[model samples]
Target: MINKYNNSNKDVKYLYKNFLNIGQVGLLDKFDFSEDKIVQAKKCTLYTESGREILDLTSGFGTQNLGYNNDKIISERIAFANNNELPFSRLFFNEDVAKLAKKISSMLPGSLQYSFFSNSGAEANEGALKLAFKYHNGQRKLLIHNKDSFHGKLIATSQITNSPEVYFDFQSSLETDCIDLSNTDLLEEKVLKNKDNIYAIIIEPFSASLARPIDFKTLLKIQEICNREDIVLIFDEVYSGFFRTSNLFYFMNESDLLPDIVTYSKSFGGGISSVSGYTTKEKVFTKAYGSQKDALLHSSTYSNYVEESRVALKALSIFSNTNFQEEINQKRKYFIKKIHEITNLKYVESLTGDGFHWGIGFEKIKLLNLDKLLKLLPLEITKDPRFAEKLYVSSIINELYRKYNILSYAGFNSEIKLFISPPIIISEQEIDHAVESIIKTVEKKPLVLMTSFVQNYLLRFLNKN
Candidate 1:
């Protein structure tokens, strides 16, 4: 086989050059072309140039629950595609879509039986919001979202998202009435006072911004309030779904509370291109878009993309299997124990998360050098809010690439939290390596040695060049 990173390959060189020119490197811009480029992936690992192996901890932003290039899912998709299946069958029903919908609905708890397929997480959230408004006849106008929750990037989802920077350019179109996620009392008051005017109240079961897990009791209470006031409760489980949080669904495992509408996406496709449908009670669907004319109210051209749906169907099967859940729980317990043991690190103020998703909050860490790293990153990567924290993580990633070649992203912004959601197929040894890398990075005072050692290295590199 030809070399993976052969500079002679004009296609690869052209792509890399274009990436450097137009990429909007954001968040701590640390990743660059000079680094190893991954050309193939398998299980929980990526294969880069020079045969370097990088363990994936972020799981492509938590979409690869089962891990990269799952063999079974790939086989299923290939089988579907080999049959010359049409991807877009407008207004026509396909068996794979029906079967996938049935499988997803079967896995969910309660009367969440209806499924509306979409191509992305944002589309799923948008569908959910539209469903909520249609169900309540648009009389209920306000939708409540948590302060640090990330829904999606569509116009509606962007509005509900609490990040000022993400929605900075789209201020005019963003929603104006989202409440602070922590203040439950205010949420209750708003729901009670605006029952007639409120369409739905959406929340991330696990708060991504604070890296805090919502209390089960609080979630239950929110459900109770929504129920009492006839407001629709929507759980944006795009990030916390499909065993990422130690359960089949975060809402199902975290609490007994049920929401009127629940949206899922990430990890559903098993790292494939597919998105997912939102589940809701039969009544909600009937009340919202009961007629044929209303069917088009929330449909996507890629709603039933054949290959993506096939992968999703297989992925759902993998997650629903009992053995996978048992294995994941065992691994989760061990991982949490190891994190707790690293209590002496000064930067680690607290560690919080459940299932496969978790975060580490840093107290104080100067981030100038981290900023320099960010300036070097490519632009396709989303800008994280926790810049300092991300910079620290990028440093660790860079070191790992230099030595062990492990690659992972710093989730959120500069808040000192490293978002981790390794693939379900990750080995114990891989987890140990990740933990060791993180602990070593946190304990070592790289910033302190910057003036003497780090600066000298930079100066030497500049002189040599």
Candidate 2:
């Protein structure tokens, strides 16, 4: 079968109807926004087909931390590609992999000495789960996850994901028990009840659900409980890893506790489509590597892809350089200060998140209307959901894309949660542009409604009694 790239609006619609049917086209089709609206991106800015400049606020869902078309990264990748490096090779030693492992080990605190690479976050989590089981000799069987937390999309990780939508299709396949992140009492009770059976307690240190910091005290308590129960504490830091959270690692600066296993992806690849790593204590590897057979027990085809490792090494090098963290902190402080100033809108419940990853809660928006709008637009186009809490978020990503060209990901099925995670490399001028765009978008809804009849229809659909 020949693969065709859909460029025109008619082509996209035709392909959507003919080729893609079951796949959810949340934001792409709903808004009726044309591909022409997207300005091909270069560096940090995106240009529309009409030559409108858009300051990217979402950072391609927080993957492009180094920004779009980073010259250094691009050049490095080009050099690697030109050299004809084999990304996948069985039974071979790659120098790039060793270099990346060395670089990662150098940055990590304590004895997180080993690195295992994978293609995506889910694959990394799968490796961690298998390693945890193998380390404990399979005596532990239960995999505990926090409620409403996202880990990955693979079977094992999906089983542990708290989102019902993620598990909606394969509910029967999921076999893990979930506990509410906020409920300390239940957590203790569950751990006690299944102490021997529980192999790992995996958590997203900074939860995307509320875009809030995990309670430090509760986290420490959970750590203690895990120690007492002999359960492996796994921190899934795919979304909050790197220096994106202002801290080098989410668990390092924010909480005193440490996990036995930590999985990282997304930004770790340096905006590339490959690379993921799991850090574990030496003992875990020692136990797993007791024999040669055990060493080959868990491995991926692309476990140590050279190009990805090289990118990861370079990304880490960039992260470790001085001034990166300071710049991130400065930007975060400025953003928070500006966000606090915009309190005129009554729909915003609270703003939460760390470093570059933040969420706006809409406590006062109408959920039904928000759902209708979301149904009509692409998932990235709108942030509001049906929940009263979601409505109060009082922000429209579509307007941001329209006036300022800043694209953000809006939450689904919830009342209100808008994720804003830009690259750490964003300049102050870009930051100012993003903030101004947000301000303009929030204040200029009337104008937006005037331009798009869809917006007017959505408003009327929302206002109907």
Candidate 3:
């Protein structure tokens, strides 16, 4: 198989189609203006092989919060290459493990003393659940998670994801926690009913994709319930942590409420390293894996990585700087004020989220005879419920990329109308350009954008295929 296209097929597209993933190509195929080969990236800008300079607003889905190729973050990786020294090992006593654990513990709430490292959000979540089960000594039978919560894709975590698309939730495996936070009593009822059997309840404090935060009032109530019921409360801040949403942690903005375990990844690696971790209270850590006998029980081979630790340490320092936060705050206020103005448009139905991430629900404004004209197409593809949404969003995204060279993304799940979450490091000029591009794109008639998109997409598709 390797020999079939080893040297004969040097095309990157061909390599992806044959050896890599065909789905990735299929996903990108829908976006005509997507860069095929990005040659360089620094700060909020991406340089492509086609000599195009794109302003990246998605921040690699919240991984590159410090911006791409950050000088400070990159220097750590460079030092790692130059020195190549092993800072610590998983087997014997590890300095990085101790240092990072202590460092994160100091910044967070006083009780969140111990930490465990992993490779990704899902792994961190899986570890969190394992810790909960171990804390209960495998006596508990249920794990609770919020509806529409995306903890991870690993089988255990997937069971609680509640995603209908890629990560289909095994509804029967895990118990549903709460959805209608407005009902106030809904969470308490479930927690009380399952208190004896529920080991842990996972929650996403701020969902960046949907641009929604679990209400602070509801969170305070959950904290009270968890304290009384002995259920481990886990806050999965994979995509929302590391000042991606203006605050160091979403929960920090309002009042002080700590969870039993907090799983974090994404920007924790400083946009370069792959590191995820869960910090838990000392009691939870000791009760779960206190003894040396169970210490190695729930550990990954890649956990406690020294290079990753070095990167994370540097990233943490960068995040802790007062000047850095001040600059980001100014940009954040500008972005919020600008995005808030979009709600005035009749097309925008709802607005959620805050800081750098926002989800705007758009409703179609019926045209005189555009539907009739669209119905005449070869297939009535517009009949799907999401067709209008996809049309409006995809068109806007494509236009932004093509005309303004700005990159943005749609929210996740079934009802993803629009998600606008740019990198925190984005400049005022870039924000102005990106927001204006979106406004102009949305202002266009859906039919007009669709026609242009189809033609351009076909042109690009034909040029490549």
Candidate 4:
């Protein structure tokens, strides 16, 4: 049985040991959080084993959009538990699953009327890939993916991802073409060059790592190209989905382009269950898996999990409310303003992103002879290399957690950006406190920042060993 522990140092050691045993030692060392035990989370604040309160700006990497321990959503889960509902089998029809499917299909704007439920963003992308490939009758040879776009870590998605350094060992079986979505000329050139062999062009409207919206003209141009080439256009909205982007979907209120397929997972389950899905048009579905024999072809045990389905349905209902969206918008405006205030600091390069999702980027100050030292590192250390930007971002993340008790994320792109994805329900007071804490965190003495860098370097050295 899982029981809460009030022990501080002892619990931390046990957790670290278990993390090491699970091969997550490097991940734990990388962040180097000041406090290692979180016993409970209430709304936007996390409570430690010692009963210290820490603001959770990470929002579980944007999954806890509605915040933790949400009573309303939890009540739904309690009801399901009381009913003692059995897990739905793939071979049989489930009313709750069918209701959720209809609700999702009808809720999506535009022509996206079909959806396939799964357990993760990666699984959803896997489903999307299978559909895209099958729709073309298996003749299309290449998938055009954008730079800095993170679709998933699965086989097909990993191959198409631009962040090869992060997935060095998990190599892709199929060849893929890459293009920078920010450069319109380069994007058109690559797409047109590989249009004949391309099955689909997948991208995020605003990639979380890049932390900026893609130019609308570029999206329109890609859409036009995909239309002319008969290639499916897919949007990986796993991170940018829900009202996280100030829009229901990033492509909804922001752009006029309608993608053939869209995948979402992060916030869709209301932070209560593991659920994800991909939406597509009826024609695309018909072409891909319309026949009776093919209907059950792409499925897994967790595809129709009843508990997750019920929670997802409730979450969708919550997201559909207009009043809740307006309240989120109100909070988002204040959140952006508070973040903007911190950008005035000398170390801060800029703040980028939309709505409640933003990243704080630091000014890049080159270290002398760093590249030479990096070159001398072992081949295994060099294989899935971490760049200067990622290290700098990691330092900032560590400093924030250590000094201010605010959890944040570090971007992995060429320019490291510290990400904040606080719950939309966070109050203006909480926002002010977080901003003030960050201001102090960023304004730390040069010696403090240097120590953070040293800690990071030592961790990397340990990783190398």
Candidate 5:
């Protein structure tokens, strides 16, 4: 096999060059991997080309629930590859796929037994939306999503997602509206107003970007509303599934609060296989694509291949172990407490989150607030309120990687918030190390922190070079 990385700056340049040629350069800029490129990883620690050991907190956006380079997953992949079974057609009956589906069904709540496999979380959500739309006989055209919620980037899914500016080009022309999660009154108002034309209400169950988990009572209320109006409800567990939130799923453990359709991926494949799936009740499946004539209506070419299926089956087994779940809960409490303790720092505004996920927001120092100082001079900086805070968090993240080898990121589109979502397997020692790193990284001198202003200039120079 050809090598993807050569442990050199040339390789990094080639990766960035092609990445900027087609993809969003802003994403690359948000992450400062300029010092070295990662060549291997084990659990929560990343091994870089320059022999630096970096602790991963993002878990590749929460996909590595079991952490990286899992031995069992790797052995399974090798076994599957050695068996010469791959890229097989899903048209034929595959025992491994059926078994995996059955395993997943046993763990899901209520009558969510029927399954549809796909390649990614986006594809699973796309299939879920289609299922909901077809279940209602294409009669309901409107969908509701909570503000700052992320579902996927597919055309229909993107329409229901909260960030219109990011995925607007992929949006559907259909009617869709967003409701604020902070106000249940407004949420209910929107649901009632659009009750007649609504096909579904898709949500992340827990807002990944905001690091907020919806209370069980609120979820029950939403479920009741959807049921009363005959609207399909979808829980997008792409980032929260497979014990990331100290639960197999945030919506699990409650029989009455189950959604009509549940979409999952990310950690479900144990960071080994790119697999995703959607599950619903038999009634909904029958209404949508259960007919013999609609057998192949929503299937994908890579849907239920044997390799991904076997890997998912193993992943489910590992995640469902009771002992593992208990340990994860303990880790969650420790992690959250440590993060909250950091709020005592002068610059930290607040720590908002639950379980193993969190967002650390910073306060602008009055003395060093460049914008405020400029206003004193009868001049002004950018009007964005979070500009200074964003720069501060970005600088902290950069320093965290450079000084302590702990990976972190600014919250999605939010300047002051730093996202912390380490793998479930992360230990107490690692958590303590992360907390110390964050404190030391953020508690820098004002003049030293101001150097983050060079990011724009550095980006422009890199793009030109």
Candidate 6:
């Protein structure tokens, strides 16, 4: 067990603090057992250096849909190594690339036949935006996005993102506008008012970041408007695609409406390869990059590599071959029933479910009587009313991991949201364990929770100094 990474002479935590991101260190290095070091992962479980098993509920932020180090997915990597295939040369004639693109196209409904490969979700979305502009020959000057969503951190994608925390303040290259999805009437008016300048509308079918769900009627209205006005509709499914949200693609299961383009990543790589792509209809692709002169205009050096495509092909196979509707339906029902039982717990405020994605809101601080403790905490987090609730939720997240072996985290929801995004491969037994643990954790008085959170931070600070 004394490997190079786990060597006694080398301190990984020190390296992370000095060389890597210190903030990121807390993601794995907290809870009551802060000394425990996770050295191995398999099938939704993380093993510490001392052999402690921690059930992973975050799914590595939804990238591990099939669980960690999945055997079937690793087989693809082994096959490629034995064959000594082209890992990367920017070659245009690889069979796996064509096969992957075709496989992705076939799984989706309608005329989404063309694909532009990339290395991340942001790149794919950026490409989709570019395609929209080219499709209109620069005649369109505006893009519409939702204020409750996030697309990516890249320049163009960041502009479209509306979340206050992550959204940047700089001006955008394109004229961007926002709409409130809750009001369908205002949504229609916004689009009609800017019909001439509008080129595309991008939205997340399911806002996995915050466990937000879209109404079927609103979706249809947007589809109708886009179709009538010849505007492009793009679905940013980076976090919710590839059966992570209980569907092959979230939009397809909800309704028969088809989007002009769909950007995908995260689970598409099967927790192995880092591959992403945006799929669109043949007509859109032809209008944007059909000519031989423009076909390779937007290509990336690392866009279509053999190894990534092979692994992605196997990942897609696992997703497509399995019949998940029955499994998702049964598991979701069991989880919902359990959540309903815990709705009246002492600290539990609101509980909502959407497939495997869920949100558990905590009661505000004023009701919790944490005024004294709130004054003692750092000014940065305590000053904002919005962030105060976040700290309250963080306490629950900490206790959830400290007392129980389960891991949960705060979502990007505007309110005090404790998001539980478990892996799709989770079992009935695992679900029972997680639900029971949550109930026990919430039953504790909020005052006790806040006290523990303060102590945890104090401990971290002392150790750092």
Best by TM-score: 6
Off by over 4 Å in 6: 1-4, 7-10, 23-35, 323-329
In terms of lDDT, which candidate is stronger, 1 or 5?
5
Q: lDDT winner between 1 and 6, please give it.
A: 6
What lDDT does each candidate get?
Answer: 0.72, 0.70, 0.79, 0.79, 0.78, 0.80
Worst 10 residues of 6 by lDDT: 1-10
Pick out the ten consecutive residues of candidate 4 with the lowest summed lDDT.
376-385
Model 3 alpha-carbon miss at residue 193, Å: 3.0
Model 3 scores a C-alpha lDDT of 0.79
TM-score of each: 0.88, 0.86, 0.91, 0.89, 0.89, 0.93
Q: Could you report the Cα RMSD, in angstroms, for every candidate shown?
A: 4.1, 5.2, 3.8, 4.0, 3.9, 2.3
lDDT for each residue of candidate 6 in 213-322, tens digit (9 for 90 to 100): 68767888888888888889998999888767657777887657799999999888889889899999999999988999888878788887678888999998888864
* Between candidates 3 and 4, the TM-score winner: 3
- Report the C-alpha lDDT of model 5 over 199-313, residue by residue, as the tens digit: 9888887777777788778888888888888999899988778877757887885667889999999988889889999989888999888889877778766777678888888
Q: Itemize residue pairs with steric clashes in candidate 4.
A: none
Error of 2 at 57 (Å): 1.2
Instruction: Itemize residue pairs with steric clashes in candidate 5.
Output: none
Residue 88 in candidate 3, Cα distance off native in Å: 6.1
lDDT string, candidate 1, 287-351, tens digits: 88889888778776677776688788888888888888788878888877776765668767778
lDDT of candidate 3 over 1-465, digit per residue (tens): 012223332276667888999887666776854444676788998876667888887888889889999999998889988997785566677676678888888778758889998899999999998999899998887877777777777777877776544454344444445354435488777666766887887888897656788888888888787788898989988888988785888887765688999889999999999999999999999999999999789987789888898899898888888898899899899988888777776567888887888888877645444575456443555665566567667877888888888888886475665777777988888888877777787777777777787777767767866
lDDT of 2 by residue, 1-465 (tens): 112333755566557767886345433532423344453666677766556676766777767887887777778888888988776676688888888888887887777887788888888888888888888897777888887788877767777776744746554443478888567789888876875888888888887555777877878888888888878888888878886675777888754677888889888877875788798878777786568778788787778887778877888887887786667678778766665654565445567778777776654433444444456744543542342333223237555665556777665422247777787777777777776766666555332332353564465446643
Range of the 10 consecutive residues with the lowest summed lDDT in candidate 5: 373-382
